[model samples]
Target: MSGNIAKHVFVMAGTGSIGLIAIFMVDLLNFFYISALKNPSYTAAVAFAGSLGFILSAISIGSSIGISATVSRLIGAKKRGKARRYAATFLAVMLCIATLLAALNFIFSRQLVSLIGGKGEALEGAVLFLRILAPAFPLLCLVMAISGLLRSLGEANAAMRVTLSGAVCAAVLDPIFIFGLDLGLTGAALGTIFSRILICANGWYQLSKHDILAFPRLKEIKPALKAIAPIALPAIATNLATPVGNLFVTRTMSHFGNDAISALSVIERSVPICFAFIFALTGSIGPIIAQNFGARIFERVKETYRWALRFTLGCVALIWLIFFLNQNLLIKLFHIQGIGIPIIHFFCDYLVEGYAFLGLLFVSNTAFNNLGFAFYSTFFNWGRATLGTIPFVLIGFYWGPEGILTGMTAGMALFGTLAYFKAKNVIHNLHLRFPEALA
Candidate 1:
């Protein structure tokens, strides 16, 4: 809170990106190994299952946002005891919610997959994967909550190790389970489940070592809910919007056949790896902004916002250049064939630039969530997912599969630009309301 704001953003985001890359690398490898089998059905199955997993994970991610924002704010205001209690209570609540959702998904796995256009071998494989993976949702929630707490406490390195442990575990076990054991797709699911367990255990240890979490009393639960619900509910809604859009896109692409879905799957896996730093920026910057806001340091809050946006633009440019140069390599590595080849090529050549707008939207979202306007985050994200996405994607259908990708990019550019301005306006309004803080 007292250091150079740019340094703080870079250090925090860089460390956070390493952890995110580790986690996402595991997913990329999962898809890569599955693709090596040369089965389009297998690739499409993971794609469909991954989309559903995104929705379930959104619940926990949103809850963690609440925990992180509320606790970071309290800590900045010098209320450590209350912050710890809120952290514990939020974790418990999130775990319960995640477990319930996981159970429901497991019970109706086939129907859920079918709804998203999975069919035949792909549908069966997706259902199998979902059922194997669902029970671990509670563990995933625990890991996310703990990581958010560590970040709120400004222990960015420790927070990073929590995810790194899981990634290492997955790296070692994925191959043994998938190949040595000849378990195939089921092995991939089992590997993921084990990784979640490792992450949960590592995260809990990190919090305990720091004495940052306390057991929540029954009386604390209701008050905690009252404090956190304002942020968590909207954050949950905001996070859900992406998967909702992805689901629509996936269902739409299914019309072009499994090859189209497979191409989309490769693109999906590649994204988190390439733009990991930008993804980290969303979680990393929140605590920085929330802490300053809590301390009534409006100027610092504004400074952090500006620096984060600049960092995002630079990161996008670097990643886009690399992706463009290696488009063919990616196609070859993913073993993309048939119509999938053209789709991958088109994305690398054109759609990769869309991520810049998506990055802007991410920064704006963190600003909204931390600045006491989480609903704005929800509004813009839903607008992007629905209005920004659906109609554009429909229009793109006129030009076929590549057209769909174009439409998604157009939606992102529109909403991302609007969200950036809205976030700027929000910061301006904050300054007006707290003029004394500026001095």
Candidate 2:
């Protein structure tokens, strides 16, 4: 049992390392432009636009979640053919959804930015960015489906490579387009689209090579859609909560001027970089748990949860220490000036501690989803978004930018604690009822 868990972690971590490097490299490149521009309002605009894109792109992942859950179960039941069918179905669904989303992005780019409280040059930049990236939504969705498919098959390394390839491509292109070509914001968006196309193509090649991915026949589509919809909707909703909550946070930050909004953007982008391992652990273990659960190996399911939480929290601690010890150097790396600097400082100093609890929340969400308690994860997250975020953010509004971070920390602490206990109880009850199934 120990050996298996260790192996899964190792694979997951290896993928996680590559993914982290890729994500940070892309984000850092974007920030390099922001820093080089040395304009707070411009930074805020880019961040706001980026946030809109980020939130919308997340739904594609929701589709992948449903696909992953289905694939894991099929694999656990030793139903390889059915698993591949779902993979085909996933591509079909993602393509359809991505088309609609991309159209919306193009049509309502201005309104989308406006709704997010973007205005002036910031709004203009956001509209340009979204429009430029709009067409790639389908490609992005397909990439997500492929990655989730690979992870379900216990091919985290392959999935990581696909993601890394995109990241490396984006990082390489970002500088050339943004600076070499002097395309400015459009360059950034184009860079992103090109990289995503690369990822999608690579993913398709792998899936086709494995004979696992295909365009579904009309007949195969309905049943596959039926199976995925139930899981996908709630899973999507669960994924939506954070970004929805972030919308509120971003809107709140907007009132504090471009500096505050830009600072929040910087931190948001920086998170995946700093806590990539935690994110990787959360994703990597979901399939492991789901496979065990599907096979009725309740003990292994429970063990994965405990080990994952421990491993994730440990990563958070180590990251926190690193961030704390070198906070000054890290701050300088962003080349931020004026208000953004102080805001960044406050985050590194005090709010950074909250990440441990956030790690707990992430692991708990994965556990719930993999354990067939998708609604529970959804409820907990949306509950946090509303009951947890609104009140704390309101309270923090009184203290300015630093206070917002405090409010965020408070909300996550409360919700994260509750989620941990709820998941613990759920796991305990499962073991109690299925004691004889502990194979």
Candidate 3:
């Protein structure tokens, strides 16, 4: 606990906290921009916002994973000086990449949203959201890198503070800016960006205090990148798949009209809360798995995986119980009234059914990703996103929004089965290969 264990938790807590809020940020955006949520334009805005956030997420995951991997490995190997050097170079590279990303995003905010089908007020709203949110990129990257470093170092408690700060900021500002100021969707985006900025500042301060922020240096970046790329790339690929799946979901829903799309947006924003326990489990288990795997404590690695799976699945099951008992009331919470009632019943039923299928898929993919089998995780997602699911959604063009949900459920149920089988194979193989590890 004094060494790698502490550092990993420290980073994990901060990263997970931000991750949790970031997961819910979509809802925050909608809550603030109530009109945008209902406007076909708003759906597009939501799509664009989701796409951009995800793209950054992919980049951040890739960059941070690599950085943390390289530094942590060196530290594990007792190469303290080398670890420091690696951390310094990684901070420089990631900051530059994040800054340039913000700039590029600023330039092409409108165009990017347009590709995802944004038009009219939604497009304008998206541009406003992106333009405002773009500048936070550098800070986000820096903080993610620093936070990852801290987690790698076992200053997890500090890292948690950084994320809690962002979540708290967004949580508080959501009501004040969105409802109070009536800033709507833009207000939500502002609150989220503001939160990220705050985390960035805090993360940077901690990172610098720990001497991880040695920017303005050009030394050894290539080697550092090389060291981190293998580990990070898979995680990035896994991260990118969410947006890819989102792109199709957006396209399919839009066919039913703006209102249908809007309803879909609401569910997307809200459903994650239902899966919170599983995600928290993944965050905690990943570093434990990573460190144990690093140290060649193979038995403990397998044992941890089993415990994580059982533990997560149990929590998910309990959540499902609560959801089942009060789904009607839960659906009512969105207050998706007014014109939103168009496909409201459809959404309520869809969530009730689809959540059951997604339960297995979501937890399995998370466990795989955390187990460092991220490429496998991404493959499952890519299958769901592009290959098997798109055809199912298209079959519903004539049926309207209800058909879209039905088709989506069908595709996911099919793909979720596929993911489940693959995960079983993985779990089976691990158990067999390391019998003593699990013992």
Instruction: Name the top lDDT candidate.
Output: 1
Which candidate's TM-score is highest?
Answer: 1
> Considering only N, C-alpha and C atoms within 3 Å, which residue pairs clash in candidate 2?
none
lDDT of 2 at 163: 85
Query: Taking the tens digit of each residue's C-alpha lDDT, what string does model 2 give over 114-158?
Result: 887898988888898878888888887887888878877777778
Clash count, candidate 3: 17
Query: For all candidates, what are the clash counts?
Result: 0, 0, 17
Tell me each candidate's RMSD, in Å, in order.
Answer: 2.4, 2.5, 4.7
Per-candidate Cα lDDT values, in order, are: 0.87, 0.79, 0.66
List where candidate 2 sits over 4 angstroms from the true fold: 1-11, 20-25, 75-85, 287-303, 435-439
Sorting all predicted structures by TM-score, with the top scorer first, yields 1, 2, 3
In TM-score terms, candidate 1 sits at 0.92
lDDT of 1 at 230: 81
Residues 54-141 of candidate 1: C-alpha lDDT, one tens digit per residue: 8887888888878887998788899889988887887787778788888999999999889989999999989998999998888878
